[model samples]
Target: MEELICMDRSQRLFEDSRKVLVGGVNSPVRAMKPYPFFVERAEGCRLYDADGRSYIDYCLGYGPLILGHANPAVVDAVAAQLEKGTLYGAPTELEIDFARKIAKHVPSAEMVRFVNTGTEATMGAIRLARGVTGKNRFVKFEGAFHGAHDYVLVKAGSGATTQGVPNSAGIPADTTKNTILAPFNDEEAIERIVEEEDDLACIILEPIIGNIGCVMPKPGYLRFLRKITKEHEVLLIFDEVITGFRLGLGGAQGYYGVKPDITTLGKILGGGLPIGCIASTRDVMEHMAPVGEVYQAGTFNGNPLSMTAGLAAIGELERPGVYEALEKTGGYMRKGLRDISEDLGIDTRVYGVASMYQMYFTGEEVTDYQSALRADKELFLRYQQELLKKGVFLPPSQYECNFISTAHREEDIERTLVEMESALRTVL
Candidate 1:
């Protein structure tokens, strides 16, 4: 067995935190077994914990730090914005600049409305869809997490799945009754739902299901959705919070060559800051606010800091070879992990695309949430802990996808593979 890394300071902090914080962490997924390590600071692709232990971070702040932590461009932009002011509750030129950039890159973003988080972005998108179509029902795939909103919590992935509560207790039955759940990669299920439910407002989904350990869409699946949703007179909304800039500047919509009626972007769009946006065609977006009756507003929406950071972060992404480099590294990592599992004769399924990946302990392919649920969660957690001992930090959940950043160099990837192999050996 590998010797556990010392986390005495972090252990003490967790004890103190538990008295005041829920589950000793703000987010449920941060609740790692044997207590989570409290990060003191992060730079590039590494996290320095309270115990002074450094780890190569694949969590990447849950998919926001694509350019990596404490990026100079983002830091400088935010710093400059701080000198000017923080929040104005009023419009700024920076917001316009950021929105313009989003429209330039994202295929579906001709107009935009900024919000505070991915949750807010999705909530607004769903509401807008309902208002536009004057319909009550919407379709979401099983184990696909849009956010922690009441409407989409029925079969959520991420922390909800990790905590063994896909359906939370507080939500009323009426809220979820209208939410129809379908299995991913299944066209027949969607066809039935569309035919049966006459008042369907929209079909919202993550193009690549990142919440359920990065499941890719089957061939023609996205195109199938675009066609069917159009035929049914239902709007198509793409929740690209994780995949927005992570896949490429165009996000999953561009990568798959299928555009949606509405797109929700967060995470990387904020550049490690709090930001989310619901974007669509000018005609659709005009339906929001003073322009139209679908009301959505926030004090922090289009706040200067997030706008500045987003602009700067995206500007960096606009540089040549960024996506190519990320693709190459991602491919390398996936191949290496698959090879290690094969070499060890371990029963595992490696899944990923671009800079996202995960290894399910089950031998079968993970094409949907049901298959993903069959993977040995306890075994995956054991492997995660083992990797932590070797200075590698994953998200600490089998259901959450691991990420790679531009800050991750060749040496980082090589060392991670070595550690991963050792961790797999120790656990399996």
Candidate 2:
């Protein structure tokens, strides 16, 4: 049987979930149109949904599950940690070890402070920048989402940043008063902003710009930002939440060979658990409390459960050929997609670095948010829904990037292409 009534079963669950949940989900991204599937379990590259439908999972928990879902190493590590404890509401050796691992792997992470999510990491970075520089204003790119926090929300990247504007509803107008927005990949705009707004404490950006559909900086753009920020005495922060440990060992900073004054990390660091970190030189980091006067703390800041998972995840990622394999797979898939799109006579542009990618439904290149926005939203939606129907799950919205994991094989990529060809045929 083809699971003919499976959608009906899924509809009932979503309808029931709505009564108790906001927008029927915890996060807005989870609320895809026609209802998102409630997955029962996941292993390797596949997810088993509540209705017993097996799907090829390209979402990969939005870029964290690089080792893939329920890998034995990750599960064993978590299981072992369970014997010790969960949340101590205090510090542990695991946190220190994990921090050390991050410092060793990530080139710019000299000193790190942990938080629960990428949102907190970027939010704290902004606050700390203001505290250190004694300035109120900041600058962010048009489509680089740092998090849901009010200060960096404007011209927000990803979900909020994708549709347009800063905050959806919860933020006050005064929150974004000091936050200035500029077009990504435009060196002149940033140069002008620093010249005009002398009070800018920091300039933060995603080196690879994953949220705005996996766009990359134009040639020398990242280096230009670094040079401009240094000349202005403004701190440069790389919001590598999605890029950290995914693109390469040291992240986009390492991959692009451009170093920023500060870097925020999440996603891969936690191994699919909740964790984020902001790091910089010791002098700037000393400004935080216990070292200097800037105050920041968390009750569950370095939970052992997440720390153990993180430690294990980072260790496993260190294995030789891990990233190389991911890149190879990513390259294979990208080529397959490009070939298919070309065959279908669909105008498309695929942009990326390493395992992260986005397919823009336009012939034009996407060097920044403005160019990324030129992609076809209607076609993207139709394609996404069609792919889902064909048992392959891409990011629900066109704004998010498609992530590849080490678990994905050549067969998986070919299978995805097969499904993509079918979907393209329908959509075109």
Q: State which candidate has the highest TM-score.
A: 1
TM-score of 2: 0.97
RMSD of 2: 2.2
Q: What are the clashing pairs of model 1?
A: none
lDDT of each: 0.94, 0.86
Name model 1 segments beyond 4 Å from true.
Answer: 1-7
Root-mean-square deviation per candidate: 2.5, 2.2
Instruction: Score residue 59 of candidate 2 by CA lDDT.
Output: 89
Candidate 2: lDDT of 195?
93
Residue range 173-259, candidate 1, lDDT tens digits:
987898999999999999999999999999999999999898999999999999999999999999999999988999999999999
Judge candidate 1 at residue 147 and give its lDDT. 92
Error of model 2, residue 341, in angstroms = 1.6
* Candidate 2 lDDT tens digits, 69-138: 9988888999999998898776799878988888887878788899889999999888889889999898
